[model samples]
Target: MRRSPWATLAVLAFAQFIVVLDVTIVNVALPDIQTDLHFSAENLQWVISAYTLLFGGFLLLGGRMADLLGSRRVFVIGLALFGAMSLLAGLATSPGMLIGARAVQGLGGALLSPAALSILTVTFPHGRQRNIAMGVWGGLAGLGGTLGVVAGGLLVDSLDWRWVFFVNVPIVAVITVITPVFVRHVAAARAGDRAFDAAGAALGTTGLLAVVYGVVRAEPAGWSSPEVIGFLAAGVILLAAFVRVEARAKAPLVPLGLFRSRALSTSSIALGLNGAAFLSMFFLTSLYLQQVRGDSALAAGVHFLPMGGAAIAAAVLSTPLIQRFGTQRVQLGGAALGVAGLFLLMTADAHGGYATALLPGLLLFGTGIIGVGVPAQISAVVDVQRHEAGAASGVVTAFYQVGGALGLAIVTTLSLSRTNAAVAEGASHQQSLVDGFHRGLLIAAIVAAVNIAVTLASPQLTPDAELIAEAAAVA
Candidate 1:
């Protein structure tokens, strides 16, 4: 049976959407999860961090698996694992069980996400088709984050918080069943191919997990604390070791040569910085709306509709902009807009209304993210060889996850410290929270400025004729 390209794109895009949605869907339901499971405030954070840590850590190994085992096979297996874990998470009666399930869910996402992207990269030609697909993919990616908050609120308010996990069951089932029909199966690795580097996988995964764990804990334990310092140092050493292993291994988990492509390397860095700005914006805004503005979860979610609309519009607009201006220029322009947006957000006060203070910033920030994000994604994979597509996708995604985690940790710690100081000096609770948020936004603005500078300094990336021809042949 033959499948339409659009159908294939839809299936893959939906898979990516659900995987990304899980990242933020649980946020709005956290309070409910904590109360139902009797989780302490400190431990509650683990509910989010556990999933993020494993998802970020195991991505490389997962991408390698997609290359060795067929993308279709690995994708199906990931879906099965993710669905099973989601069921387990929904049924959990204890905090331990839920966290464990979430971690496994993260691993499932690690396997599924890059495999989906790899399939898209190979299935779509590298010119207009791929660009449009990427625009759709990027649009859904942004929409998923916004939608998760809305969906979480709706599910929690209308039914139960557990429904957030349960929601994945039907979606996964539908996709799993239809995927084989739509996505063609690729040939798996030959039996005599190079051996898998077990050492590299172990070191890389552990190193990432350690680093993410330290960052996540930094909010509660100060950055100077022994626990934070020890974990961060160990993670760095392990990562250095992984690099050495990769350099010498017969079949490395990641090929160091992939970095030779300036486009991929620079785009990866740009994506990381963009991730930092985007994630912090979401985190701080959600807190500001609920804690300072006293909006209900449902109300806060609804309020984000404007941001989501803006992102979708920008996603649609990005393809033409890239065609006209090139990826480098569009990306830099987007980062500049993000800086402006963050600076505008810095002016928000405790007494400000959404229309007056939040709407303009959210609009610009949402538009800015889609501008940067879609182009960077295209740039990461457009010049890579077919065989290396999964690894490149994984690297880009890993940077995104790691960058967001690190940025959120830094900004959260700084904001909370400032908030505490303001409280000590007799500021109202609302005012103190706003003050901290301002400081965090200012830091985020500086990060965006850095992104703009980096983009300007990097060499412009044009589409390679050979790469486009190769991708066209594959498609």
Candidate 2:
């Protein structure tokens, strides 16, 4: 079948939406999932962290697999695996089973996300057509995230939390059936690319996993536990070894040269900051809406509707903005919006109404993030060769996940610490929680502010550049 590029993009974007949607949908269902499955509070966090941890850990390897094997083939495999795991999660009889299923879902997401983005990179020609494709891609990614909460609330209210996972089954099945008819595979153009680097794969995956584990524990372990220190130390050492291995390998899992590209380097670092701010904003605000404002899951999700709309609008607008003012200006503009949004959130109180309080802040935060994010996404993968598109896509995606995870962990800890201090000072629990949330918002504002400086200082991007430089440091 000779499918048009737009049709191919539609398939890819839908798949990407499904993966992104899963990231947040589960948060609303955690209480239900835990109650039904009898998860300990300690283990309940894993329902969310399991997916994020595994997804971040395996993203680099997954991207490499697409490059060496075939993006289309890997895409199908990933979709099927994700669908199967979704079913398993829906049917799980215990916490361990559900958590394990979510872990596999993470693996599937890591594979398909990079594969889909890489396919888009190869399919669309650079400039206007590519810009449109990337815009749609970025828009839907944000849309998926914003809508996940709403959809989760609806599902949990009307049906059951289990339906959240089961809903993916039909969507996956339809996409899987139509994929090969539209998405074509491109062969790697490099010599000796067929050889696999087993050693590199092990080191990279394990190292990333170790670091994510350490960060995840730092919130609970107070960042000073011997186990957390040990894991962080091991992850760093292993990553260092992975770099040496990449430098020496006949076929590096991640080419050392991709990091040489200035556009990718700047876009990637800024994306990490954007990811930290964007993701943590959602987490903290959701807690505020639920705990402080006393809104139900459904109500909290409904409140985000305006933010979702603004985010999509910003994403669509970014393409023109980027084409007009260039990447740096659009990114800075977006970062400014983020800082303003977070700063506004600092004024949010337990008694503050949604219309005058959280709504305006969310609108700005959501709009600003997509404004920053869409351009950074386009910049990250642009100018890379067809052979390395998957790797490039993977690098950008991994940074978002890793950055979001670390940011969430650090800010959650800050919030918790503040909440504890306020309680010791005899404040009401609700007020203490809000105070903690404000502190986290302040830190997030600072992060957004830093992104402006980073954007200002980045090296000029060459139109001919390839791979990612800063990403090599991340890996």
Candidate 3:
């Protein structure tokens, strides 16, 4: 069947929007969930971390599944599974049930993200067409992320916090019913020869989970404690084994050779840093609004609208700017904006006013993120073969999520440590929380500076130049 390329882009972009939205939609609902389910303080972060960990952990495997099976089949199955899990999460009567359901939903999202991207990568086939489509795809991912907090705030306020999960129903239903009909399917590449990498999947998934578990738990349990040390050690060891297995496997889940590309390698590195900066800020800002300033969930979400709004504007503008100036400039400029933003955020205090203190930083960070995200995505896929596009896309996405998890863990740990010291000085709870947030934003600034430096080192590639290469290569 002849497929409409515009329809395909719309479908894939919609899928990405939904997947990214789920990441932050729960943040505004966290306090409500905690109270309703009576969750312990220590485990509340798990509401976020669990989804990220499992999603990041199994992402490579999911991408490989798309390669070995069909993208359409995997996409449909993933959407169905995700929708079911979302329903289960909404209906949960206990904390354990909710967390478990979230984890499963993450797994399904893991499967969906790469397949959607791969479909876009192959379907678009690189040029002005692909560039504009991908820019929109990346933009929507950014937009949905911003919108999640805002939507979560509104939803949690108007109805129950559970509606955050329940709202996926109609969106999922539309995607599931329409996707197969509109989106062209890519058949498995190595249908006969590819055997599932059971051992590799087990090792990689468990290894990442162990590392994330250790890091997330480090804040509550002191880093030197036996449990923290043991988990970190085990995580490192298991991850080492996973790499070894991948190197030796007949049908490796992840092809290490993909890293040989400077574009992909540097891009992924920047992606990790960007993820750290983006996710950690969201975590800290959400807390600052609710815990420190005593804002309601809806109000907190509304406060983030400025940041999100700025980010969307910047992202939409980035494609043309990159076309004119170059990818490297856009990225480096974005990172610089982020650094300034974080520096501004460092001035945030318990008594800090949003207009004078937070708004400027949010705007700068939003603009910078748009600059960084779009070019980094371009670099990640630019040099890859069409056949390897699925795996390449997945690896980048995995790093992005892993970076977020690690960034959150690191920032949260630093926040806790600083909070402890402030508390020792007899600071009030809110004041201590604000102090910790200040310290965390300082760390975020450093990461953004590094990104700016690295992005400056990347090569220039304009959209027309890329399209020229696409034409020549096709001929």
Candidate 4:
């Protein structure tokens, strides 16, 4: 049966949307989750970190699996696991159960997201078709995070917090039923043709998980603490081992040579920096709106509507901008805007009203997000070989996840340290919190500025007309 390319895109995009949405949806429901689960303040953070650590850790392996096992097969399997875990999460009566379910949910996302993206890369021809498809995919990726906040608010207010997890069941059910009908399966690699680098996979996955775990733990434990230092050192050693293994392996899990592509490496770095700033923006602003401004969860979500709208608009504009100015220029421009937005946010004060102070910064930050995000995503895979698309996508996604974790840890630690100092000096609690948030916003601005510099310095940002032509020809 012939399947429409657009139909394939729809199925893939929907899957990506839900996967990304799950990342942020839990944020708004955290309070309720803690209350119901009787979670300690320290343990509460695991509800999120558990999911993130596994997701980032397994992403590369997931991408390779997509290539080895077939993208459609991996996608279906991932969706099934994600849906089942969502059910487990929603029915959980204790912190242990919910956190355990969340960890598996992250694994499902790791598999589903890359497979879905690899499918899109194959299904759509390069040039205008791929660009447009990526525009929609990138736009949805941004929208999903924003929408999760809104949806989480509504669901938590009207129903129970568990609805946030339960909501996935119906959506996943619909997508799962329709996916096989519209998405064509790519042929899996022959078993005899290539060796599966199990050693490389183990080293890389453990390395990433160790790094993410260390970063997450650093939020509660100081960076110099034994646990943080030990995990981080272990991560670095394991990753180094993985690189050595890849160089000698008959069939390496990650082709280290892919880093030679200036486009892929530079864009991956810029994306990581952007992820750090953008994800932290979401985290800081949500805290600012609720903690400092005294807004309810619902109100905070509503306030973000402007930012979401701005992001959607910027995403729509990204394709045309890329065509006219090229991906590099657009990305640099986006990073600049992000820096400007962060600067504006840093000016926020406890006394200021949301409309007066928060709205403009949110709008600019949101716009900046799509500007950097869409171009970075497109550039990550644009020059890669078709067969390596899954690996390329995984590298990009891994950077985004790890960058967010690392960046948030750094920013949060700095902010909280400052806040504690202020409180010790007898500052009001609200003022101290606001001051800390501003400090974090300042660091976020610096990160965005660094991204701009990186983007500007990369020669691969130049348009490759021949590459696009070759891709289209092959398609």
> Whose TM-score is greatest here?
3
> What is the overall TM-score of model 2 with all chains considered together?
0.85
Q: State the C-alpha lDDT per candidate.
A: 0.79, 0.78, 0.81, 0.80
The regions of model 2 sitting more than 4 angstroms off are 1-10, 34-45, 93-95, 117-139, 178-192, 381-390, 460-475
Residue-by-residue lDDT tens digits, candidate 4, 240-290:
998999999887767789899887888788888887887677777776776
- As for candidate 1, its clashing pairs are none
Cα deviation at 28, candidate 4, in Å, is 2.1
TM-score of 4: 0.87
Model 1, 1-475: lDDT tens per residue?
Answer: 7778789889988888988888878877776787899985445556776787678767877777887888889999998899999999999999999999998999899888777877877788767788678657766766787799899879888899899999999999999999999998866788787377778878987887677667756767878999999999999999999999999998776788999988778878888888778777777777787778877777777887888888888877776677677779988888888888898888888787789798899899988887787777777777788677656767777777767766666666667778778999999988998988898898888878888877876566555544433332222
Q: What is the C-alpha RMSD of each candidate to the true structure, in Å?
A: 3.4, 4.4, 3.3, 3.4
Instruction: Give the alpha carbon lDDT tens digit for every residue of 30-92 in model 3.
Output: 888989999865566678877887788788788778878988888888888889999999999
lDDT value, residue 410 of candidate 4: 64
TM-scores of the models, in the given order? 0.87, 0.85, 0.89, 0.87
TM-score sort, best first = 3, 4, 1, 2
TM-score of 1: 0.87
